[model samples]
Each structure stands twice: as C-alpha cells, then as structure tokens.
Target: MSFRPVKPLALRTGVRWKIAVAIAAVGALIAVTLSVVVHNAARISMLDNAREVQMERLLFAQRMYETSKPKEPRFGTKINDPALPAQLDQLMRDRRRGTFVQEHRNGGPPDVWAAVPLANGDVLSLHIPFADRSTAIMNDLDRALVIGSVSVVFGGCALGVLIGGQLSRRLRKAAAAAGRVAQGNTDVRVRDAIGGVVRDETDELARAVDALTDALNERIEAERRVTADIAHELRTPVTGLLTAAELLPPGRPTELVRDRAQAMRTLVEDVLEVARLDSASERAELQEIALGEFVERRVRALDPDVVVRVVHDSWVNTDPRRLERILGNLLANAAKHGKPPVEVTVEGRVVRVRDHGPGFPEALLKEGPSRFRTGTSDRAGQGHGLGLTIAAGQARVLGARLTFRNVASAAAPGGVGGAIAVLWLPDHAPTNTGSFPMLRLSN
Candidate 1:
C-alpha cells in the first residue's frame, strides 16, 4: 500500500475548488442559453405587434386619402418624405399596401411608418410612435434577466464551495487516521462505523481504513506473540546449557562453550525485551535524578578508562533502570564497533555519547535500527542487531528521544570518521553544575 504526503495548502486547488468552478461554468451556460431563447421570443413578439398596429394605421390613412381633405386632421401627403424607410417607400411606389418599422440608433422607441401610393401619384403617409412604455418594459426585462443569471451562477458556486469543504474535511480526517496507522498507532480511527443507505464515498473510505487498520493490528500482534513465545521457550533450555557449560573443567575449549552459551542466553533475553517493548508491556518508573552525576556513574561502571564530561548539570524525571539500559547499550555499541576514548557528555537535560572510529554505517543513520538485519559486517558489530532497537524502544518508554548521526556527518561509503548519539530527556533541567568539573575522568 502506498500513501501520499500531506500538503496543507492543497485545498486551494483541491476537489472543492474544482467543483465550484464546474458549477459556475454550468450555471453560466444555462443562464446564457435561457437569455438567448427569451430575448429572441420577446423580440419576435414586439415586431409582430408593431406590424399589426402599423397595418391598422395604414388603413386609416387610406380613408383620409380618399376624401382628399387637405384641411382635416388626417394623414399628410408627402411628395417626398426623406425619413420614410427605403423599403416602405419602394413598396408604396409599387402601389402595394405595407408598413415598416425603424428602430432608433440611440435605443429609444422605434418609428412605425404607414404609407400608401394615391391615385394622383401622391404618397399619403403617417408616422405612429412605437410606444416608449413598451421599450422601457423590454429594457427592464433584460436587466432583470441579467441580474438573475449572475445571481444563480454565484449562488451555485457558493453551494459547490460549501459541499466541497465538507467532503475535503472528512477526507483529511481519514488521511490523518491513515497517517497515524502508518506510524504504528493502530488505535487511531477516522470515524465510527459507517452505514445506512445514504452513505457517501467518504463514509466508505473511513470504513475501509478502519477495516485495514484492524487487520494490520491483528497481524502485528500475532507476530509479536510468536516471538515472545519462542523466547520464553528458549529461556529454560539456555539456562540448562549455561549450567552444563559451567560444570566443564576450566580450559580454552570450556571457555569457548561458556561464552557461546552466554551469548545465546543474552540473545534470547534481548528478543523477549524487544517483544515487551513492541507490545508496550513495559512501563517507566519515573524519578528525578541529577543527570550529570548519573551519567558519570554509568560510564564509570562500564569501564573507568572511558571519559565523562559535564558541560551543564540538570535534574530530570525518568526511569533509572531504563536509563541505565539505554546508556549501557550505547556504551556497549561504542566498545564493540566504535573506537576508544569514548566520551559521554552531559549538557543540561541532554546526554551525548561519542566514539571516534569509522563512524556508524550510512544505512544505520538513514533507515534506523532493524532487528536481525544489522548494517554491513565491516562497519557493524557482530550481534543480532537488537541493541539500538532496544535502546530506541526504552527511550520511547521513558518519553525521551534517542538520535544517531555521524560526528561530522561525514559518513560515506565504507564509513568515515566518528559517530554521535544524543539522548534528550523530556522533563526537567535544574540550574546546577554540581561538584564535578566541566570534564571528568571516568575513574
């Protein structure tokens, strides 16, 4: 299974924003379609009404023309009316009954003209104003349509944004839960059991994640139990072997057997300890201690030839036994794989172990410790590779952090220079340098 890294700022271009853009685009399309259809229909209706009104006015002018009443309030005869539309004039000149409407360029009402060719070759014509009221109503309708279309598009975009936010939030929760699971916190869950017919994709995702986590947790537990059981089974046999080896007469061969038996017992014990750490079966016994003084004593126990330095003293609350184990493993690693003049430094609440040698393997620093798969033999000590792993686990139990790096970060292929291991205590630091000098010999 693969997982993507979290990008906090991705929300700007994530699913929600895409959904909003899609919704706005669709709304704009619909509004434009509606606008075009309505506008055409309205324009056709207005033109039909204009033709009807102009046809009636043409009939009225025909009656006035027949009477030849020049003084009456009726249609005017135009020998030449320049304002008459060319189409209308040509139609009348052909002695056909027709009308024409001309729209004003300045967006006012149109001019409706009725013209008829008289028997005496005079054109009796009258102009009827296309009502300003009708044009105003059309203009208002257009404005309303524009405002409505804009409103709908914006409203849809807002709705899309809202829905997208809800979906992304749920997805982020699921991703965070998966991240926690990847980090070995199997208890983390995206949400409760998802069900019901109305469930969405997010619900399905959450449910799937929960299922996967449960399966993974079960598998991990089964493996841990098996390892623990094997270690328990080996303990009695290994003890018996140790007793038998000790009974042999003192000689080089007897010494070899004893050493091998002891090594087997230690390996078994280390496996059991690792299993306990994995299952979180071990708990820290916290107690405040003077850090500088504590470090000096542990290093002295390991070998008085080593050196201990106290830059600044500190008081911290942590499990003494576990702290000793952690320091022991670090010192032991240095003794085995690293070179001497091994120096332990105590500064404030932090402790550091340094060894001048070929340095830690590049792989160890990069990928961290893994059981039974130690680094290259040339660069690593001969062991089951559980030393650093147990140290790391114990540090976690004590709520401290153990970090490893090359002394000058100059470790390359085949190893180069020295290595430094830093242990940072979580709790406290008291402003006390203590009775020890800045540099103290382990003796």
Candidate 2:
C-alpha cells in the first residue's frame, strides 16, 4: 500500500475539519494534563495518609513498651516487621522520642516504617503496608478520568462541527454570489443567496457589490449615449465637407482641402471603432498567417527604405484587418515622431518597430495613448493622437499586447537612442495548432 505525504494542516483539512480537530486536540491535551496531575496528587495523598497512620501506630507501640517495660517491641497485629532503618535509629537515639522516616522500597506492597524513642529511652519501631483499599480507589479514579476525557473530546468535536458548518455555509454563499457578479451576471444578491435578515460583514459586502454594479451600469450607459450622439452629429458635417471640397476647381489647394476632409472622415470612423472596442462588440475573424511574411509585406509597404528582419518564421492566428491597422499606425507614428532608418523585426509571435529618435514622450509611455497628444515640445504640431490609440484598441480586439519603451542609443547606428514598440500576437488559434518552420522573408 502507498501513502501520500502529509500536507500542511491548513491544506489537508477543510474549515470544518480544522475547527473540529483544533477543539478536539486542545480539549484532549487539557484532559490528559489534568488526569496525570490528579492521579499523581491522589497517589501522594494516599501515601502521606498511610505514613501518618504508621507514625501513630509507632507512637502507640512506644507508649506500651514504656508502661509494660517489655524487652522486645510490642506492635499491633497490623505491623509485621518492627525494625527501624539505620538512619531512623540514629535520629531517635540522638533526639530521644523524636520522629524519624525511612525510604520506600519497590516490592509486592508499598510500605514504610517509623521509629520513635519511648519515655524510658528505648526506641520503638513499627512497619505498616498500604491497604488494598487505597490501591482500589486509585484504580477507580484512573477509569473515571479516561471516561471523562473521552466525553470532553467528543463534546468538543460536536460543538466545533456545528459552529464550523454554519460559518462555512454563510461564507460559501457570499463567495458564490461574488462569483456570479464577476461572471457578468450583475444581478447576484448576497442577501438573497444567504436568505437571512441578519446584518454582518457579508451583508455589507453584498451591498457594496450592488453599489459598484449600479455605478458601472450607469457609466456604461452614459458613454453609449454620448458616443451615439457624437457619431450622429459629426457624420453629416464631415460628409458635407468632403462633398463641398470635391466641387472646388482642380488645383493644389483643392487637393489639400480634399485631403483634410478625408482625414476628418478617418478620425470619425476611428471614434466609432474605439467605442465598439470599449463595448467589447468588435469580434475578430481570425486567420492563420505566416507572421514573418506578413510583417515584411506590411513594413515594406510603409517604407521601401526601412530595413526589415525576420528572425523566425512562425504562424499566428489573428484578424489581418486589425493587424494591418496596428502595423500601419505604428509605422506612421515612427515616421512622424522618430528619426530615419526605422526598423521592423519579427521573432516568434513578437514584432518590434524601432526608430532612432529621442523615444516616446514620458507621459505617453507612462499614461498610454490619449487623443491629440503630439509628442515632445518640438513636435507639437504633429498628427492627432488617435493613431496610437486606435492601434492599441485594435491590438486589444485581436487579443494581443502592444508596449513601448526607450532603449540605449549605443545599440543603434550612429549611437542614436530611440523608442521601440513591441506587439505580441497569440502564437496559435484555439482551433488550429500546427507548427510552421522558420524562413527569411524580410528585406
């Protein structure tokens, strides 16, 4: 047979078991301690009582020897041997009628002898063995102690089970209610789950949960109404501006107007996309793609001169449209905010876009993307901040991570410091898990 190693007390025992075992153990310890102490105390008391009786008998024998003037000691039938220990004899000889005691020996029956000097200067010694009645009484005490200890332990265990079960039930109900709230049920009520009017910490927790749910519901509804109003109010004006710009005479100014109008339309579309992402309504139509080839093609489209490196050829399942948007925004940001020689590298499921520039603004890196946050003091009139924001939103929808950091300049050519953007896509889709070999597909 095999046995599992002992686990920690907390882990091995349930709440109920822990409580029961704790009470039982403490009770058992106290019971055993009291029993041992009581047993020893009773035994000592019995021995002391027996010793006192023996001394009285020896005193009586001393009186009889003095009055009758007997040559040999005269002890009652209760005493068998009438001899004093050498130490007791010396003490009685010196004191003349003083009390004396001898050590007990291990034998059939525990006995002790006492010596006393008579009035005529003759010492009288008497031996007295403990009665069978004393032994019988001690045995009865031991039996009673065992029974009482067993009763106490059982009572402690029962009380612990009752209390522990009630407490565990209340806590488990509260926990289950919290779990439902986390699962988006939002309708879970702890008070209802517990089915009690009692006021406690658990009830307070339930009330707090309800308050949080209401606040979240209100905030989400307000955001939805605001987003709808903005979309409705801006779409018409942006459309009219684009239409009006197209009517202008053919010239550089007309082209500029059209471009600005198109940019406005793009911004409006991005706002709607962001709202959808926030509401978690945007779903990805995932597809398996060769990540190295995909990243190479996207980077080359953005900048023909930019160097691209594919260290690994791995397949990832992601929405290509969202992936393209994320890559395009990153490339555009790099070109606009960073210095030349932008590099894109793909390794495993990670793609890194780095630029030899002063790096991202501290606020942008720390607080993340915000609307209209053009980086640094010199580049104040840069593009609107929606590009990185949209990129971040799209990455989230695709279940990927986008992060930015500044690196040491010594690593880059000309010893120029720069910012790096890292995007990590999931390695494989839940439905597809096939291996793809590495290939050099970047220029």
Candidate 3:
C-alpha cells in the first residue's frame, strides 16, 4: 500500500489549520495596508517639495530680469537680455536630468514635467520628477514593514506553540487515565491541576474519567463483598461434612455413609454451580431450542407428580445447560418451600413454577431473593438459601428475567396463595453464540 502524508487539517478536525491560517492572514493584511499608506504619503510629499523648488527658481529669474540694466538704445529700441533659457536649463538639470532619472532608473514610469511662462515673461515649469530620497524612504518603509510583520508572526506562533503544547499535554494525561480505567484500574485519576480552563474539552474529559472511575470502584467493591460472604457460608458446611465423614467407621453401615457422602457431594456441586454463574468470564453457550419442550423435560426430571402445562410452542435460543440449571433451581425451590404437586406452565418463552403450599413470607417476598434466605415454611427441607439466588444469577447469565411473587390459589388448604417463580427468556440467541461457557468457582 502506498502512504500519503497526513494533513494537519485531518489530524485535528481542521482546528490547527484554522488557527495558523488566521494568524497568517491577519499579518499579511496589516503589512499590505501599512505599506500602501506609507508609500502613497511619501510620494505625495516629495512631489510637493519639488514643485515648491521650481516656483522659487521662477521668482528669482523674474527678479533678475526686472533688475538688470538695459543696453544703450539702438535703432530707437532698447536691447533685451532674456535670462529664462539659462534658468530653465539650470532648473531642468538640477531637478530632472541626472539623479532624478538615475534614482527612478529601475524601470518605473517616468515622472511628469510641464513648463509654463509666467505673466512677467519669466518661464516657470513644474518639475515633479521622481526623487531619490522618496524612493529610498519607501524602500526603507517596505523593509521595516516586512521585518515588523515577520517578528509579529513568529512571536504569535511561539505563543501559540506554548499554549497548544500545554493543552495537548493535559489532554494526553487525561487520555492515559482513561486507558488505565479501561484496563480495570478504577483508582486512576487525571490531574485537574494540569488543566487551566474549567469549561474546555480537557476539563470535560477529566470529569467523565472521574465519574467512570467512581462507578467502576463501586461495582468492584460490591462484588468483593459478595465473594467474601459466599466463601464464609460455604466453608462451614463443607468443613463439618468432611469432619463427620472422617469420624465415621470405615466398614459399618456402608449404605448410610454413602447417603451422607452423596448429600455432601450435592451441596458442593450446588455451591460450585452458583460460583460459576456469578463469574464474569462464565457465558452461556446459546443454541436454538423448543422453549416449551425444554422446560417440560426439566420439570418432569425433577418431579413426575408435578403437573406440567404447555401453553406455547415458540422456539428460543439459549444455552441448554444454563437453562436446565435455572429451571432445576426454581423447581427445587418450589418443592422445598411449596406444597406438592407443583404446577409448571410454559407459555411462549416464559416458564412459571407455582405450588399449593403456604405462600412465601410477605417481608421476604418484598425483600426479594438473597443468598441463604429460606422460606418461612419449607415442606421438603430447609434450604441453604442459594437456590433462589442461583436461579436468579443463572437467569441473568442466560439473558433471562426471573421474578418471584405470591399468586392467589384455591388449591391451598386455607384458600391462600402460593409462591410463584417466573422465568422469562429472550426470543433471540446470545450475542456471542460461539464462545464456550465458563465454570468459574472462584470469586
């Protein structure tokens, strides 16, 4: 590929070009204006002085003629001596002949001249020839104007350099801070002292960087606290189970020991699953599946007695493993806290799990799903409270909406309501369908 020079205009949206061009234009205009005014004034003054000199010569010639003595009369007429010719020749030589022509010898238009006889018979001529002095004065003025203009332009350019350098430096610092924030460092900050003006683009960029840094810090701190809580909750049960297994006899009641081991394994698996869903790296492996069939199969696997109702056959794209986990958690929560047999309904991409047992605690329902929060009256067993939390987390990972509420039901013994969990999946596939799902167990 051929390379082309990057235009200064293209580099910065034409701002730099505008500044430089404006400076140059102002300098050129000032220089041209001053030169024209000074040149015209000098030319007019020089011509007026030359005309005055010519008038003085004519007056002197007339005075000499009037004062000179006449020769003796011959043939009854007085003799006359005309001194105008010599005076005229002298005036022409002094004012027009040599230096005047030599000074304007650089091929400019010739100066104008006119000879007129005065009333006293003395010849007076206007010698408005170009003056060497005028030419010299104009040339000096031209030089001075050019020099002054250059000085002003260069000085202005130097000042602009100082200003633009400081501005670009501050912006670069802010850009570096933004890069650090993008790299996940929330503590990075642009030095506000580096910026001079408070209402410029640099200041706005600094403000935006600070706001983004604050938001990222808050989110990271929240995630850290959640991770600590999860670790604290899981360690206790795992330690107890490990200790009990070690204390049990090696050969007695093998079936009972197996049952206890299986329970411990299930708890560990549940904790691991929850951890995986909470991870940022973990993403769903999306695929198109029959929404109604997928929910019906998960419900049947969990409990055959549960009445599964299908109301729609719309297809949805989602990760099958994640969907299974989410549905399993909802069903498990319903069976544990609600009365059997549960009613599972599928309509479109929405799955509703309802039970005939006593409804969830009003305060807990309002507070919403939290880690380790079990229902007030659990029918199947008391939970570790991770069931609802895991379900909600997995639903979020799968880009689905999970909601819990109390629904009125006549099937309950007291005609009260039961807890209802609704999972609504999106109608489209995951954004990155080809990326593998991560099973992250660490915070």
Q: Top model by TM-score, which number? A: 1
Could you tally the backbone clashes for each prediction?
0, 0, 0
Tens digit of per-residue lDDT, candidate 1, span 165-242? 777766776787788777666777766522234569888778888887888788989999999999999999999999
Cα lDDT computed for each candidate against the true fold:
0.80, 0.77, 0.66
Model 3 per-residue lDDT at 42: 71
Among all candidates shown, the one with the greatest lDDT = 1
- Residue 432 miss distance in model 2 (angstroms): 15
* Candidate 3 error regions (>4 Å): 1-257, 377-380, 409-415, 432-443
- Poorest stretch of ten by lDDT in candidate 2: 429-438
lDDT of 1 at 134: 74
> Sorted by TM-score, highest first, which candidate order results?
1, 2, 3
Tell me, what's the RMSD of every candidate?
A: 8.2, 11.3, 17.5
Give per-residue CA lDDT, model 3, range 378-439, as digits (tens): 43366678888788877877777888777676775555677788888876534454243443
List the pairs of residues colliding in candidate 1.
none
Estimate candidate 3's RMSD in Å.
17.5
Which runs in model 1 stand beyond 4 Å of their true positions?
Answer: 1-16, 66-139, 193-198, 248-256, 303-307, 334-343, 354-368, 376-379, 404-420, 428-443
Compare candidates 2 and 3 on TM-score and give the better one: 2
TM-score of 2: 0.55
